[model samples]
Target: MDSERDELLHTFVAEAHEILDEIERALLQLETGRDVYDVLQRVFRATHTLKGSAGSVGLGGLSDLGHAAEDVIEALCRGDLPLTTPVVSLLLETVDAARRLVAEVERGQVERSTSHQEVIARLQEARRGGPAEPQGAWATSARRATEDDAEGATSIKSIRVAVEKLDRMADLIGELTLGRNRIVRTLRAVRGEAGAALRDEMEEQDRLCRELEEAVRAARMVPVGPWFRHYERTVRDLAHAHGRLARLVVVHGDVEVDTAVVERFRDALTHLLRNAICHGIEAPEARRAAGKDPCGTITLHAAHERGGIALRISDDGAGMRRERIAARVRALGRHPAPDALPDHELFGLVFEPGFSTATESSHLAGRGMGMDVVRRRVESIQGTIRIESREGHGTSLLIQLPLTLATIEGLSVGIGDERYVIPLRAVLACCDLPRGSLAHGGAQGLMVRRGRALPCVRLRALFGLGGSPPPDERVVIVALDGFEAGLVVDSLDGEGRTVVKPLGQLFRRVPGISGSTILGDGSVAMILDVDALLGGVVRDAVPADALDERRSAPSAAGGSPG
Candidate 1:
């Protein structure tokens, strides 16, 4: 039927785009990287695969382009054409044409887009000058056919599922989790024999519920490798444009994160990489004078840490000048004494809006932008980013992100009568705030625990709630990166799996609060933005009327979160 054909066409287009991205990365690698023969063979087979699939789908234009590209690859493998800059550039342009053809197919025009004659003509012209194809040239290292096992059918390790379907599954599982929490809470009050029996069975049900929730979230997790690899061409092109040669090195890239994380952080990561290339890396002459490698290195590393994923993008470049950044902050009147601030806080100033240390703006960077967008994007994902730099050495921006935004291990704490959920991952320790132990530091206070001092922010005062500090005030130590801060609260209610629901546009810009969740007693609990709270972005005073929606416990918290 037409429906089946359309579906198959859609699948082919999706896969073809992925193939194009891989070809671009391999082509870039061919110029500067090792293993040229292997890379050439891979390119040859990918082109063949593209051609076969495009033909099967009735995409004659894409198939033709693929065939043309295959000829160029064959010439390379035959040693008839050299792998020079121009060759790589021409092949990359061919990829661009193929991508346009794929887009045309995606738009329901499979038979034609444009002729794609310009690039194809260039390809043929380049081939005319090469030596004639030698006899049996493919024998030395043959391009692979689509490999098959004992059976002719290829075994599929994965299948494409619609993201909408996965999202709905997550929504249903979240409700189940909330229902499980309600059951656990209701069972706690029962103490009689029959009640005890029911509670024992409920415990087993709870275990099953947890397993189901975890399974759904795990299904949403995707390996971070391809997502990072997508930016290789960006780095390569940017480095070449600025006359600063740089290479991206990926380490432990197989670490998996939720697909939602990649969706939200893609633009943020791109901006960060742009900043690294445009501002961080130095010209080859300057690098040689500094006794460093002529080609700068940008390293990307990902790993699971602090109950979440930590993505580090670092570069061996000119690095950040702390003194210059501090002087600029003071000159801008953002901080009067930037020198007294810690390195993390000082470095964080670069993310302030329109804050740039560069004297002039250019096409790529130094327009007093980007870093602020990085901060906002990271916060929007309920993640944190910090900078570490040594002058004349290098700079690294480390981002910490939750495994899944749907739910979290949350510790409930009371401020007045209102409850809040501090993501348990960000909560280091909870203790009573001993009387007079908080030393005053301007508007904020500092808590000294075990000889280590941490800045403190009281939720009561920050939220504009009218309340006096109780004799037994509590402090929750929440930290990101190497910086620590104490969140002053009233009481600890316990811990559990808290399902997150976004607060609509009304409170979207509210500092120190990420989202909301339902707690056991059928009360609304605001999820604390540990990143915001720890980073010292305290609100002067949130209006009392504006906070009634958050502070007042909703009469029906058991209802579905919208």
Candidate 2:
């Protein structure tokens, strides 16, 4: 009986949090002054349901808070109260309070507290059309929803599985993938020794294994709609607090991706949005002075691209200034000439620790911390972030991430004794790079490909594998976020349907390597970060001779394969 009751409590907590998320989003919509009536109705209904569920579970304190919040919305619906900023803000605060109560329920603790009483009192005041009284609960209720709840409701189409269980399932799928690769590789070598029947059975098993892996991956997929909606209130409140009129516009919210990928990107997305609002968007007066609309627009767009997902956060605000960043860079005493650096390098400084141009700190930004964290988080998921700005026009951040972290179709290539997997989406083609075709030295190298100068990175040299290059080295051309590069490899193995497992923390900071996958022979192969490597090659300077060689090769079929 106790076990059943505990299960019921868990369900209630999960449902309550979902309702609270809706309430918060509704409050944000109300702030926008669009669909006010519908939003208010939705908020009221969610709170009413939350009240009933909490009461049913004997979580009286949580129920009371919900009841108070619902009353305020009901008052608004009945024309007893106005939808003033204070009213909406108070309701938003109540949502925060309810979130805390639900968290307490999740932790199996008593929900009632002094802070809950204070929130109830303020909510009552707000409902009565009086100014919501400043209460002691304000400090305690000031909780930011930093992370997402892992639990989601079960439906007829789906069963509720614990997140840990899903994680374990993914791990098992990865191991299965590794084992299957081993079997296939071994079978291929001994095809003549094995009978036709045995070969056919192994082939059938491999097919089933692939199908099962895909099914598991699909099961872990989640739509970005709910996740995207959760940030509406955050942008609204933070924009208002900073006295900036800004709106968050989310597009293509139905894009599906791995739940783990979404969770991994949570903090990074939040930080980037916050940075856009705090630094990219300017005050109303400043915007007007720049001959732009007083109100700013921040867009969160997600879509499927190249078998992966692309998320873009853009703002029509005073775009970032390269000069200002260079000035900040100089203030840190880093180089002989800061302004002489290229725009990409200047922008790259934003992700460096203690890199900021803000003159002062605020509730939302400053302290130069968010961007660095954003960069680190994106890389952790084997993703890439690209920033584009037009000075007075605006700024756009494009982040490309895999749809699922579990498995990817990659081009497995060899570099001497080591192997690496390059994402198939990024791979353009493979070709032989004749000796001496690679121009320039040091960190920068270039080759000519079909009349265009292409940057190249030698994997053996990059990873310090320290071996003689093969007589016939191959180069795999890869394209990421409009940038193109060629990765010089020892040999081109065939296509790989590889499962990606994250490397340990000790290797987390290693450049150009994202994760590791177990190869067919039970050896681990590193997954290359083509985006980062290309960016690094761009950052380095190519010698004049290399440029001449690249220019001269345009008539020689440009060094690309036919």
Candidate 3:
């Protein structure tokens, strides 16, 4: 009976942490015009559950703290006290204390420590009209108490799963697919009229097996909302620390993404939201002086766009200061002409390593590691980030990423005998090009389409195919960072979603290749890094007129390539 009770307590602790995360997110949203009743009700419910479960398990210390926290939430729900900054801060502190108490209970050691008493006092104080006690002292004591209480009792339910599990599952699925392929091949080779019925049965088995595999994959997906909630608290705390009345608004909170992608994107989203609060939103007084609302708004919205997930973080505060960025770039000996640089390029400078707009270091984000880390992490997942800023209006960051990390739709292209896959989402259009129009030089030329000049790169030359360009070669126009460019290839295969597998360590530094995917025919296709490829074209100083002429010329092979 004791063992069963302990197991139940462990489950409570794990579930309580999940609930606490949701409550913290709600409180953050409450700071930004959310209904007080709704937020308080959620906070109360989480605390109530903790209190009930802890008491049932004879955890007096946890039960006491949980009840106190619940009391404060109930009062806030009743409108007994306004949800002021100090109150919200104290509530956040109380949530932390409760979390520690739950951890102590999970360890089977309940400490009647001073930190727990302080949390009770603060909760009661908020019930009255007193300001919260210093949070720093409470934080230190809570950590120490949790450390002291570490024991044989651990919540194993919270154990981290290895990424290799997902990898192994994917590999197993691949093998199963190969098995199905072999069965089909055998069915086709069977030599009798009686084998026809057997082949039909094999086809039915294949369909059910494929459906089962897809269902299992779908079960692994977790909603991204829980991960998205953490950013709300981060934004709230950063805004308060900086004396800015910044409100974070989130959209598509219910969107489901793969668990691996969610885990990978969590830090990137944190850095982006922190940057929006610390660098984008100005102080209330400054906002008033600038003739804008004193309470700044930072909106974080996510949705599906063009077969990918688009997340945009926008702030209605002071926008990017190009002159300051240009000055920094000049100091680094990169460029000195701020006025000559485009707005998008100037805003992109923030992502450069060791670059920051902050005049001095702060606890928030002045160390210059924020945007650079964001860029690297996003790139690690084969995603792209873009920035748009107006001088005085505001700044917005647009991040476009595939829906899944495991598989992506790709357009297969042949460069010599080597095959490469361009993410179909990245390919704007494909057309055949005349051999006479493509200029041959170190720098690829541009093509003009719809009155816009688009750069053109011969895929054969770029990949060093070491053969003459095909007379009926195709040009795949890809759009990246607001620029369109074309890659000349020998042929275009059909588009399909292929599971992308990472290349070996030797190919890690290979230019213009993000990863590789295996096709239905069991052939390996290299996935092109459209950003890197187009960036290469721009860096080579390709002439604009040549790009214009290539785009205007009719394809010698008649219609669109794919």
Candidate 4:
């Protein structure tokens, strides 16, 4: 019985950690966005989960803390106590206590410390605005009512499993690689007309394998909307602390992303939003001086862009000061001639390690690691980051990320025997390029289109596939950040959604390819990084005339006035 109890306790601890993450994410979301109803539901669920699990494990102190948190969340849901700073602070402290308790449980001990009681008392006071009434008739009646409410319970239906179990399942599925190889060999060995039937069966198996992989990946996803709330609170406090009136505006809240990615990007997003409030926005007085509205506006918007999620953080504060950044760059001995640097390059300096434009370190800015860390975290997920700033107008950060780390929609292209996957989101269109239309030139290499000659890079040459350009090779036009380029492929196959898998460390440094995927035919197809491919082409050649003219010109009816 003791062994069984120990096993249950271990399961409780693991499940509690997952709930804590959800609670943290929900709190963050409440801070940034106005999804009070959804945030309250998630917070309540997490606390309720913890409370039940703690009680079952005989951790009375932990269960009591969970009960106190549950009460506060309930009150918040009922609109009894609004989500004020003091309330949010109390909730954050509650989360911290829950975390410490979980850790104690992991160590096979229970902490009977007064910290839990103190927090519970504070939360109760905050909720009631004073101490409880004496143990009179009214109090006894209220206690009896609460006890009756607690006793009207339902039977437990399900058990919470550790995420590690799912992870282990994924590993076991991954080890089916050897079986896949044997199946492939068997299919290839079938002769004559039997080969076609065998190939069909293999394709079916492949589809099932891909579906299984996607399901395993989906189990790991947690919604990102909850995490946006905490930033709302952060923005509010930072505004008050800095003597500025700032409002946080969230554009899209219903969108979801992988849980691990959300967890990884949480701090980076918070730091970015904090920087926007502190350095990106002007104070109320400064806004009035500039003839702008006195109340500063900071917008956090996310949407599906290309094949990935684009989160744009923009502020109507004073845009980046090139002169200040240039001075810092010189001070750091990196570049002395700031005058020659373009706006993009100048703004890029913010991500340079230990480089800060702020004269002094404040609580919010000038630690010098904010933007640098932001860049690292975004890039760690194979995402791209860019900044567009207009002096005196505002600064907008554009982050382009793949829709999912585990899967991608791909347009397969072939270079000789080698196949590559061009993310369908990145592929603008595929057009036939006649042999007569090819024009080779200076640094910009060959230009294919007519009006604005786009820099063209041969896919075969880029990937070192030994083949001459095909007579009827087509061009895959990909546009990124307003830059358009055409990739010349030997052959264009149709499109399909492909499950992307990481290439080992040996080939990680290889240019042009981001990752690899297995095709329906069981052939490995390399996934192309359109940005990198176009970047390399542009970097080696003279910049092509902006491709804006070639773009299907906007219709005049709903378009901006000429």
Clashes of each: 0, 0, 5, 16
Candidate 1 Cα outliers beyond 4 Å, as residue runs = 1-4, 7-11, 14-18, 129-168, 177-201, 288-293, 322-327, 330-345, 436-458, 461-471, 480-485, 520-522, 534-562
**TM-scores for every candidate against the unseen true structure:** 0.80, 0.81, 0.83, 0.66
Question: Residue by residue across 482-552, what tens digits does model 1's lDDT show?
Answer: 55556788888888887677888999888888899877556788998877765556322322342342223
Best model per TM-score: 3
Model 2: per-residue lDDT, tens digit, 416-456? 88889988877878888855766422334776667777767
TM-score, prediction 4: 0.66
- Which residue segments of model 4 deviate by more than 4 Å? 1-95, 112-207, 230-251, 281-299, 314-355, 387-396, 432-444, 536-538, 541-562
- Which residue runs does candidate 3 get wrong by more than 4 Å? 18-46, 70-83, 104-115, 121-131, 135-163, 182-187, 290-293, 326-333, 438-455, 465-471, 537-561
lDDT of 4 by residue, 1-562 (tens): 3899878987887688778777866775675557888888989988888888888878888889888888888988898877764576568667767777777777776774567787788778877855332224232322332223212110111113445565565554554544676788887888888898888887787678768877877775544454564355456546655667676777786666655556567667867876887788888788999998776788878887765688888999998888788888888888779768778777877888987777788555777988999987886666777888877888999887665666667889887888889887667778776555444311124454544556566666655566467667777877665566677777788888776667899989787778887776667778887767665644454333434343443322111101
- Against the true structure, candidate 2 has what lDDT? 0.75
Q: Residue 547 in candidate 3 has what lDDT?
A: 52
**Error of model 3, residue 8, in angstroms:** 2.1
Best by lDDT: 2
Candidate order, TM-score descending: 3, 2, 1, 4
Model 2: residues with Cα > 4 Å off, grouped in runs: 1-11, 110-112, 133-159, 162-164, 177-194, 284-295, 322-349, 391-393, 416-418, 438-447, 451-470, 478-485, 504-512, 520-524, 531-562
